[model samples]
Target: MFPPGFFDRADPSPDHFFYAPPRLVTHIDDQAIAAVGVLYQELGMTGEVLDLMSSWISHFTDPPERLVALGMNQVELAANPQAHEWLIHDLNHTPRLPFDDNSFDAVTCCVSVDYLTQPIEVFTDVARVLRPGGLFVVTFSNRCFPTKAIRGWLYSDDASHLEIVKRYFEAADGWAEPVTKQCIPPGIPGDPLYAVYATAL
Candidate 1:
């Protein structure tokens, strides 16, 4: 659904080097973060959960029974308080997840999807790892590292971002009809939160 250079980035260097330092800061504001938590709760994100592309905080108000975080930086993943287990992995280099089939009940990627150069492969692997009818929730905002973010993401608006993620799920082909929502209401201050989610088939 995108052009040849859509996934290209300004910084074409290795992702590990870009994420070497631990960024403990939250990308979105408190309100947007709270909205993410509320969405997770409402979606019944229980059981074994995989926090994909996770950082120092999972933003889960009440975490699930077992939360495993997979990210690029070891220090950042290790610092996540909500994660019961953590793995240092880069989806940009290896789109295939190192997890067993039906391993997780829910998978979440927050504010990090824009950096993925191989999102379709990652989404397909996410579906493979999820249990039947499990949720794959991808939340994002306008804020992103311009140098690392995909050209398509940097060029697109919020509505286009939602459609982008939705198309990813559709292309993956193992998910139910995706749902898109504006998690944070309009006219609210700070970064806006939006979600594109679907259930594994």
Candidate 2:
């Protein structure tokens, strides 16, 4: 378990107030963006990818051949030029994903893991939907809406955040050992960019 009271303090209102109107902006700074780009390049640029909790702008500098986005807001998903296909669904409402087993070659959740109340189960489901040797990558920075982010995420330190996400992979059962990275670019302000990624067993 992620510890009781971890996600107990979030507002109960529909996430629409927080996400209904599209902000249409990148959450990470320019330096951080470059770091993410480097990480993506390292991940390689082939096969179908599922962008979980996707938004109007994916961090990648170029488009992939096949990109599928899933998220809560339809308008935001619709506006994203990177998405080859987009599906509207709230993962918080239904953590059991609708995708077929072993479907995606790679999966990404960018800056949105803080909002998940059931991260372990969702991570387990991620492994189920990923093909053998498929990668599940989660990236985040310090920027977040404190009121909307889950309770556990609101107070956790950066090192603890890494451990927390690592635990998600561990609890998922079928995921191989995760590789943790701090995507820091020189002279960037605020917290360093971080990603915890692993291959499916």
**TM-score, per-candidate, Cα-based:** 0.98, 0.93
lDDT tens readout by residue for model 1, 1-201:
789999999999999999998888889999999999999999999999999999889988789999999998888888899999999999999999999999999999999999999999999999999999999999999999999999999999999999999999999969999999999856787889999999999
Error of 1 at 86 (Å): 0.1
Writing each residue's lDDT as its tens digit, candidate 2 over 1-201 gives 767788764686767666787777878878777777778878874588899999887777666778999987888898988899998777777888899999889898988999887788899999999999988889988878887788887888877788889988998867999988878733466557899999998
TM-score of 2: 0.93
Model 1 misplacement above 4 A: none
C-alpha local distance difference test of each model:
0.94, 0.83
- What's model 1's lDDT at 94? 92
- Top model by lDDT, which number? 1
